[model samples]
Target: MNQRYTGTAIFLHWLIAVGLIGVFALGFYMQDLPLSPDKLKLYSWHKWAGVTLLVLIVARLAWRLSHRAPELPLTMGPITRMAAHAGHWLLYGLMLAIPLSGWLMSSAQGFQVVWFGVLPLPDLVAKDAALGALLKTTHVTLNYTLLVAVIGHVGAALQHHFIQKDAVLSHMLPFAGKA
Candidate 1:
């Protein structure tokens, strides 16, 4: 198996990573502001960013399905393989769920979700205060959960590279040397 991921995969991986960090930082920082034009503008940007992530994740998922991922090294134990697979699936799930929940929450509050200020996305549910509150909770919870998952994923990658000296981490890098 190749030690490095395809160039496209590496690009998408880093792109998503940057976007996630920016989105999360914006979300947390914007909350302290009083409702003003600036606050509204920040929220608009956050909403649009979330929408963009949803679209990109869909494309990423399709690409992943079509392209085979690099194989784990032969020395990897079954437990490690299972954990890796599970972690990847969890990341995918969070990628899909976070934006979706945010969209639902926004729709419930009767806010339009415009994609990058051009395309408009249809609402997943009708406006309802109760449902909106629930979705807000879900969205916030999922965001933190995603943060933890990302940290764990990165930590594991570092472990594979620094401690195990395996191809696990290298497989996701574009120009990684042969294992």
Candidate 2:
């Protein structure tokens, strides 16, 4: 069996990774900008990226369900294995929750999500300023939480590569080989 992720899996992973970084940066940068055409345009782009990521994540989940990921190294302890699994699932959950929360917040704020400035997405909730404010907080909190989780995840992967001296990180990286 192949030690690395399938091409499609690797592609989707990197695509989503880059998308997340871009959208997250855009979101933060645009948030504090005074209301203007540029701000509105950035919001639309951010929303579009988020929607695209939602679709990509769903596809990723489907692919993951149908295919088995490589087994964890035998040297890792049961507790460590369980923690790794939990961290992965947590990432997936955040991936899903963040987009839905943003959509809901948009709806609650009386804004419709126009995907790529063309397709009109249905509002997830009725307009309510109170709920919109709360969802805004929820979305931001979830984003920071994901940021922290991602940092830890990357740290763990590096730990495997540098400290554990294992193939754990390379297996997920396209064109990567053990050092």
TM-score of candidate 1 against the unseen true structure: 0.95
lDDT, candidate 1, at 76 = 84
1-60 in candidate 2: lDDT tens per residue?
A: 557777788888888889999989999999999999999999999999999999999999
Q: What are the clashing pairs of model 2?
A: none
Q: For model 2, what is the C-alpha lDDT against the true structure? A: 0.93
lDDT of 1 by residue, 68-156 (tens): 88888788899988999899989999999999999999999999888877889898899999999999999999999999999999999
lDDT of 1: 0.89
lDDT agreement with native, every candidate: 0.89, 0.93
Worst 10 residues of 2 by lDDT: 170-179
